[model samples]
Structures are given as structure tokens and as C-alpha cells.
Target: MDANRTLALFERLVEIESPSWHEAEMARACEAELQDLGFTVTFDGSAEQTGSDVGNLIAHRSGNADGAVAFSAHMDTVKPCAGICVMRVEDERGEVLCSGGDTILSADDKAGVTAIFEGIRSMLEAGGPLPDVWVILTTCEEQSLLGSGALKAADVPQGVDCFVLDADGAPGSVVCNAPCHHTMDVAICGKSAHAGVEPEAGVSAIQVAARAIADMQLGRLDGATTANVGVIEGGVATNIVADACSFQAECRSLFPERADEAKRQMTDAVTRACERAGAHADISWTLDYPEVACAEEDAIVRRAKRAIEACGLSFQAVRTGGGADANCLRGLGVNAITLGTGMANFHATTEYIKVQDLLDDARLVEALIAEYAGS
Candidate 1:
């Protein structure tokens, strides 16, 4: 496979704007590219459900008669409107680096998408033996996995296996464990009264919220868990005792019980604070996505480790508190793991991926396919 060709494709994909629920043009581009690669592609109804102009793209490439293996990634980014202008560079050690400017280079998942595309291209060019390959490019992954959530598990091809190439850190690092997240909104309602004249008659919802927040345990809660109240808004005027306040919070943990425990604590704190202040508290919580924890010795994980090592990189399985498309693929009952594309500083303007690392990831993908075909 030509490294330059793959790098070019990665740059092109990152430059495209495909943020959250706005993935129309990017989805179309993926569809066109998949079709050009001689794959039969289908567009699901996730767009309408997700409020996007385009839906998820599912493509199938039939080769050897072996069971199908799918490679997946999301087609979106959390952004500052940065257009991909990838620059290829090498340091003294001859490591590949791909970057643009002050904006994000979008190696996050774009590199993953490009790698999968190039892998397919290489197989087609080589001709002869190859396993059945399926491609799933999802939308609205950044908006809490809405696209994957809307997708029907039964719609995925039969006898399907999957690899979601959308993670960070070293190339060999395979994320076998990730956390489930609970997104919540807490509202506190209290009776309003004149602050200067009848302060005692009024209950302060803001005070209730303050007490709850003070009592809540946020940030790091052991190595595998965390909780935080990110946004708070309440009250109308300072002169009057505020009658309403609300806060948005979330808890994430690798273990289901840990997340549930955190939510329970949050609920207790909010209820106690409200009751003490003679106010009503309303709590609404939603499990944004499920966790995925694959054993280190699992066959798929072992195969991926071997593939990475074959490509001249170290292989290791890891656990992460972050969620990804991998979690959603696992939800589909695919034995999947998240692979890094060397994306750095994700969800920030400084995000970048070494051009050489991008090439390495592409080679890693090829190695994975080759291993599967041989097996």
C-alpha cells in the first residue's frame, strides 16, 4: 500500500466538516468513496432519526467465503471549524507525523476511516484471497452515540466481526474496556419570596443546589470511575429569593455498579439538600451508552495484538474511562476493540496526529486484514 495515498485520503477526510448531527456532506463523500471501491453501500434511516441530513453508511465488500469482519469509525468531530490540511513530516527517529495548523488535524477517527479505506483498496489491488469485509461509518457519535443507538443490531450483516478504529494513545494499545456514562439534569424548585422583607418565608433553590454540589463527589472517583456536575443555571433576580435552579451532571465508570453507585449518591445529595431547604427536587437521568469490557485473552484481542506486533509495534490491551464507537459495536454483540490512530489532544484545538503515526495505523489495519485472511 502507498503511504502517501493513504495520508492524502486522511487529510481530505479531516478537512471535511462533519460535527455531531451535521454529517450530511461527509456521509455522502464516504458513500461515493465506498462505491468507487466496488462495495455495495446502504444508507440507514439514522439521519432522519438523528436530525441530520445524512444517515449512517453501511458498505459490504465480498471476497473470500470466510465470515464477514467489519471495520467501523464515526464520521464526526468536536470542532473549531478546522479544515484538514495534513502535512507529512518525520523526526530524527523517522516517525511519521500528520498535522495542519492551530486547528485539530482530526486524526481522531478520520485517520481510522482512511486506514480502513486504504486497506480495502490494497486488497482490491492485490487481487485473489481475502476475507469478506464490511464497513460501517456512523453519524452522531459525538452526540452521545445517537447514530449507533438508533441502528438496529439485526441490520448488521450476519456472522459479522468488528473493529472500531477510534481511540488515542500508542498504535498497539487496544482498548478492551471502556466505561458506561449517565447524563443527568437536576432541577430544584423553591417558593419565591421578597429577599429583604420576607427572606425567611422564601426558600433558595440556588442554596439547595450549592449544598448538593458541595456534598457530591465529582472528578476522579477511583481509577475506573468519575462524576461531575458540568453546568449550573438558576435564579431570576438577586433581590428576590430564587425559586428555581438546575444543573447538568454526568457519571462515568467501567463497572456498571460504580456508575449506579455514583448516580445514587448524586440523587441522595440532591434530595437531602432540597428537603432541608423545604424545596422540591426533580432528577432525570439517562444512560448515554453502555460499557464494553473484553477479556485480555480473548481471541479477537489476541489476534489484534499479534497484528500490531507484526507491523513492528508493541501490543498491549488497555482499559479506558472514555467511551467510543467501540462500545456501540459491542452493543451489537460484535467482539470489538478500539484501536488508536495516534490522535493527540482530542476535543481540543491542539488535536493532531503524526503523519508517520497515521501511516503506521494504516499498516496496522493491513496487518489485521492479513492476519484474518490467513486464519
Candidate 2:
């Protein structure tokens, strides 16, 4: 595969305005590109549910028709800025870099998309091909994996082993473990009264929430678990006792038992705090995504290891609290693993991926395809 060509493709994708739930134009461009490569493409019914102008772009290329290997990536970026202007830069050492200072470069998943595209392109352009390659580019992944969440179980073709190229960190790092998260929103109700006149008559919801927050254990919990409250809102005026308060928080853990324990402890803490403050509090919790922990002996893991080995990179299994589309696939009972693209400073203005690493990722995907096909 041409490294420059792969980088050009990634740059072009980032330049398009494809934020969560608004990926019509980018999806169109990808459709044209895939069709040019002679892949059978379909616009899955995610646009209607997501209220976007387009749905997921699912492309297929069947060659060595035994079992299929699926490559997946999200086509959306996080909020703040879109319609990116990707600039290619070279430092004093002449290493290639790509970015735009004001907005995100969107290498998070765009790199993933480009790698899959390049892998397929390389396979097709060269003589012979691997097993059937199924590609899925999802939407609304930044908005909590909504597109993949709505995907029908039967729609994903059988014999399709899963590979989601949407993790960060180092290129050689393979994410064999990720966490499940629970988001909790709490609203506290209290009675308001004048501070100087009748301080005893009013109950302070802010005070109650404060007490609750202070009492709860937050930040990193153990090695694989963590809990934290990120958003809080309440209080109308300074003089009156704050009657209504609201808070939003989350708990995550790599182990299901640990995650479950964290959830139970958090809920119990919220209830106890509200009861102690003499104010009523409503707590709601939602599981953001399921956890994924593929054992070393699993076939998918073995395949990924062989692929990584074939790419000349050492593979290390690490557990992470960060969730990804892999969580969604794992939830559907599909064994999947998250692969890294060597992106740095993600979700920030300094987001960037080295051009060399980007090309290496593309090559890695190609290697994986060749390995799987040979197997």
C-alpha cells in the first residue's frame, strides 16, 4: 500500500464535517470510494433512527469464501468543532505529522476507517484476496455508540469475526480488555427558606449533595475500578437555602463483579446521603456499554496475536476503563478486540497521529487480512 495515499485518504476524511449524527456528506464520499473499489455497498437503516441524512456504510468484498473477517470503525468525531482543515506538517527531524490547531484531527476513528480502506485496496489491487472482508462504518459512536446499539443482530452476516480499530495509545498495543460503565443522574429536593429569618425551616439540597459527594469515594478505585461525579447543578439564589440540586456521575470497571459492586455501592451511597440530609433525592443509573475481556486462549485473540506477530510488533494485553465500539460488539456476543492507532492528545486541540504510525496501522490491517486469509 502507498503510505502517502493512505495518509491522503485519512486527511480527506478528517476534512469532511462528520460529527455524531451528521455524517451524510462523509458517508456519501465513502460510498463513492468503496464503489470505485468494486465493493458491494449498502446504507444500513441507522440514519432514520439517528435522524441523520445517511446511515451506516456497510461494504463487502468476498474472495476466499470460507468464513469472513469484519473490520469496523466509527465515522463520527466528538463535539466542539467539525468540518476540519487537516494540515500535513513535518518537524525538524523530517517525521510526517498531520493536524489543524483549532479543531480535532479526528484520527480517533478516521485512522481506523482509512486503515480498513487501505487494507481492502491493497488486497484488491494485488492479485488474489483474503477471506470475505466485511466493512462497517458506524455513526453516532461519539454520542454513546448509538448506531451500533441500534444495529440488528441478524444483519451482521454469519462467519464474520470482528475487529474494531478504534483505540488509542501505541500502535503495537492491543486492547484485549475494556470496562463497562454506569452513568448516574441524581436530583435532590429540599425546602427553601430565608437564611437570616428562618434558617431552621429550610433544607439545603446543595448541602445535601455536597455531603453526599464528599462522603462518596471517587477517582480511581482499586486497579480496575473507578467512580467520579463530573456534573452538578442546583441553587437559585445565594440568600435562600438551595431547594433543588442535581448531579451526574459514572462508575466503571474492567471486571463485571467489580463494576456491579461499584454500582451497588454508588446507589447505596446516594440513597443514604439523601436520607441523612432530610431531603428527597432521585437517582437514575444507565449502563453506557458492556465490558469486553477476551481471554488469551480465545481464537480471536490468537488470530490477533498472530497478526500482530506477523506485523513485527510485540503484543501486550492491558485492561482499560475507557470504553469503545468493541464493548457494543461484545454485548452482541461477538468476540472482538480493540486495536490501537498510535494517536496522541485525543479529544483535544493537540490531537495528532504520526504519519508513519498511520501507515504502519494500515500495513497492520493488511497484514491481519493476509494472515487470516492464509489461516
Candidate 3:
């Protein structure tokens, strides 16, 4: 592959601002690029559901060999990514790509996108036997895998194993386990009263919420489970007793039952606090995404290991506390595993990836295609 050409593609993609729920420009660019590569690209009808300007881009190309493989990457980036300026710096560690320090480089998935695109270009130039390939570029992935969750199974071709190129680590690292996530919104209601005159008449919802939070065992519940109360909002003024309070919390665990148990315990804590404070509590819990665990011996994982080794990288299986598009794809019955894109400090202003890592990722992609093609 042409290193300069690949770097140019990465720079162009990072230059485009594609925050969650607003990825039309990036989607259009990807569509045009795939079309230029002789792939049949189409958009799914998930825009309305995902509330994105455009649906997921699903592109397909026939191959000269048997076996079908699918690759996935999200088009959305976290906030504060606007006005991004990519800079290439050479140091003792070799070439590294970074933003201007005022904004994120958006290399989280753009690096993945660059690798996939350049890998395909290399394959085409070599004119070697290849497997049938499908590329799915999704939007709103920064928002709890919204894009991939909204994707319809019918839109994806059958009998195709999926590979998600959106993990944070070295290029050879594979995310084989991710936790199930559940979000909870709790509202505590109580009567208001004058703080100075008749403070005794009011049931302080703030106190109730504080009590509930104190009673709950939050943060690092166990080896695989964790709970956190991230947001809290309530009360009108300090003069009057607090009437209502609301908080948003989340629980995550590698096992679904553990996550559910954590939710139940938190709910019970809220109930006990409300009962003691004579306040009414309203708690709602929703499962954001299910946990995904792919065995190292699985066919897709084996292929990934082989491909990584072929690129002279050590294959390391990892478990993540975060979620990605792979979670939704696995939920949808696609055999999927997430591969690292050599991103470091992602979602931060200091995010960067080594240029050599980018080239190695592209080579890994090519190796994967060849492995699937039975070459």
C-alpha cells in the first residue's frame, strides 16, 4: 500500500467533523470513496430510528474465492472534534498523528476507516484472489451503539462473519469481551416547605437522594461489575426545602445477571431511602447494550490471530469496560470481534496514533482478506 496515499486518506477523514447524530458529510464521503473503488454501496433505512442525518452505509463487492467477511467502523466522533487540524510529528517513536491540541484528532474510528480503505486498495492493486467482502460504516456509534443497534439484520447479507475495527490498543490486540450496560433514571418526589419557617413540614428529596446514593454500593462492585451515579439534578432554591430530585446512574458487568442484580440493589436502595423520607421514588432502568464474549478459538478470532501474526504482531486478547459497534453486531447474531486501531488517549485532545501502526493495521486487513479467501 502507498503510505502517503493512506496518510492522505486518514487526514481527509479526520478533517471532516462527524459528531454523533450528525454524520451526513462523512457518510457521503465514504459512499463516494467506496463507489470509486467499484463497490456497490447503499444506505439502510435506519436513519429515522437512529435520528441520524443518514443511515448506515453498507457496501459490498464480489470476490474470486469462497467465504464472505464483513468489516465495520463507526463514522461518528465524540464532541469537541470540530475545527480539527491533523499534524504529523516524527520522534524517536517514529511518525505520530495528532490534532492541534485544541480539538480531538477523531482517530478513534477514522484510523479504522483509513486502514480498511487502504487495505482494499492494496488488494485491488495486487489483483490477488479475495473473498466476498462487506463494509458497514455506521453513525451514532458514540451514543451507546445507536447506529448498529438500529441496523436491520435483513440489510446485512447472511453467512458473513463480522470484524469491527474500533478498539483502543495496539493493532494486534483483540477485544473479545465487553460488559453489558444498563442506565437508570431515578426521580424522588417530596413536598416543598419554607426552609426557615416550616422546614419540618417538607420531606427533603435531596436528602432522600443523598441517602439512597450513600446506601448503594457504587463503583467497582466486583471484578466484572461496576456502578456509578454520573448525573444529579434537583431543587429550585436554597430558601425553600427541596421538593424533587433526579439522578441518572448506570451499571455495567460482564454477566447480564450481575448487571441486573446491581440494578435491583440500587432500586432497593432508592426504595428504602424514599420510604424513610416519606418521598415517592420513580426509577426506570434500560439495557443500553448486551455483553459480548467471543471465544479465542472461534473461527473469526482464529482468522484474526493468523492475520495479526502474518503482519508480525503479537495477538493479544483483551476485555474492555467500554462498548462498541461489535456489541450490537454480536447481539444481532453476527459473529463479531473488535480489533484495535492503535488509538491512544481517544476522546481526548491528546489522542494520537503512530503512522507505523496505521500502516500495520492496513497490512493486517489485507492479511485477513487473504486468510478468508483461502489463499
Candidate 3 residues 294-317, lDDT tens each?
788987788899999999999999
Superposed model 3: Cα runs more than 4 Å off: 49-51, 79-85, 100-103, 157-159, 191-204, 237-243
Best by lDDT: 3
Model 3 Cα RMSD, 1 decimal? 2.9
Candidate 1 is scored at a TM of 0.87
Q: What residue pairs are clashing in model 3?
A: none
lDDT of 1: 0.82
Q: Please report how far candidate 3 places residue 87 from its true position, in Å.
A: 3.7
Superposed model 1: Cα runs more than 4 Å off: 14-22, 49-51, 78-83, 93-97, 100-102, 140-154, 157-159, 345-352, 373-375
Least lDDT summed over 10 consecutive residues: which range in candidate 1?
Answer: 92-101
> For model 1, how does the per-residue alpha-carbon lDDT over 110-196 read when each residue is reduced to its tens digit?
888998999778867877577778898988888878888777677676445588888887788888889988898998999899999
For model 2, where is the 10-residue window of minimal lDDT?
91-100
lDDT by candidate, in order shown: 0.82, 0.81, 0.90
Model 3 scores a TM of 0.87
